[model samples]
Target: MVDVTELEQRCADAWPALVDEPLGGWRLRAAGGFTGRANSALTLGDPGLPVPQALDRVKLFAAAHGIAPCAHVVVGAPVEAAVADARWRVDVDHPGGAESLVMTGTLRGFATPKDRAAAVAGTPSPGWWELAAQANPTTAQRRVLGSGSRVGFGEVEREGVVVGAVRGAVVGEVLHVARLAVRPEARRGGVARSLMGALATWGLEHGARVCALQVAEHNSPAVTLYRALGCAEHHRYRYWVPGA
Candidate 1:
């Protein structure tokens, strides 16, 4: 039998590191905010461990704790592989009931300089952010502009009035682009494309070899625009919203 207390401690210590990994998904973020009221489980044993034993341990542990166990699997090495391979799950009793949504992925590298530059120049950026602010002037445009680690370039102007902007910054060799938006009236304009061009130029100058950003999968238009600009899909991430 694995020591439940030790497993929980191990998870707690490793949680932050998981957050830093782009592929760890949003689950790490959820884990950080989770109360002990949330249960977790893991298998710690030699290689070729029995799946039956692992499941039994989780069932027994969850029964005693009055909460479902979050099973963890380690793959490859003995204990490490066991814990890594072990999967965390909840509400196993109800096959169709509410379970956690998994989010995972790696940040994809962008295209080459020549290809990227060409793509950027080929299209125009939208003024979505600019329009949003006008429709709801209470939006926090300036705050998002200033909050990111680095600010790229792009602003939405309506009738010559600048209202929305996109920003980016560089970390190590990675360019993290965030907070992109355009004004309503500026929609369909090449503002975003221009901003992206500026960002690409800035990133290349700063020695950044890749640019990455996160967007909702359902936003087809945005995704299309990005694809046109040489951005490829890296991963599909789902946010397991609280209480859902």
Candidate 2:
């Protein structure tokens, strides 16, 4: 079984929560209403203040940014209980607001098919950002996807146009994957699989033995894809918002 505590810390390090302020130990993040992972406060360790005070600070910060106050709490963390006791309900309305699984796997077994022509780049290309995001990416979104010590942007091109795009970040022995997307016309053509294979190869080259990614519980297709690629659930986390 993957160690939940260690996995949590690894994830925080690999895909850092870009925050506006460090409230004691918590990360106060706001990313222009992007994914919940970037927009919510990540309550990892103790906040060095009373739970109420910490919560108050989070609320004020979010309010000032014209966004809802949300906290990303690991399932078994102490802050999860505290937030629940304070009547902060788990967010379920937003697309990625509910529980998400952290999946991890070894990269050695990933084999890129000879027929697929996937390439790994040091930075995301303009076509990659367009296809993966389906629109112009916000500055915060770009940072969330691209900012890391060792980041790889993988893409599969078809007829000279980028069709599939994915990102991988190597931190310690873990390679964190995110932003996997296939163009509408390129779906179901093994593009996603090719992209993953390329990323796994890149990860292995960068001294990463383990690969990890976060997927929403309701995304059955993506979950199935990752599972087929040897990923298993390491832990779960949810976004908690103040009040119902």
Shift in Å, residue 214, candidate 1:
0.6
Candidate 1, residues 1-244, lDDT tens digits: the string is: 1123232333223222212111111111112223321224333333133654554555554455454444432222244333334443333343222222111112232323333312221212444334323333222333333234444444545565555565555554556554466656656866666666666666676666665655554556666767777666543222111122
* lDDT of predicted model 2: 0.83
Give one digit per residue, the lDDT tens place, for model 2 in 79-186. 888888888888888687499999999897775644567889998888898876746877777777768889999998878899899988898888889889888898
Per-prediction TM-score, please? Answer: 0.44, 0.91
User: Mind sharing the TM-score for model 2?
Assistant: 0.91
The deviation in Å at residue 61 for candidate 1 is 22
Q: Find the candidate with the highest lDDT and give its number.
A: 2
Q: What does the lDDT read for residue 183 in candidate 1?
A: 56
In candidate 1, stretches whose alpha carbon ends up further than 4 angstroms from where it belongs are 1-145, 156-160, 241-244
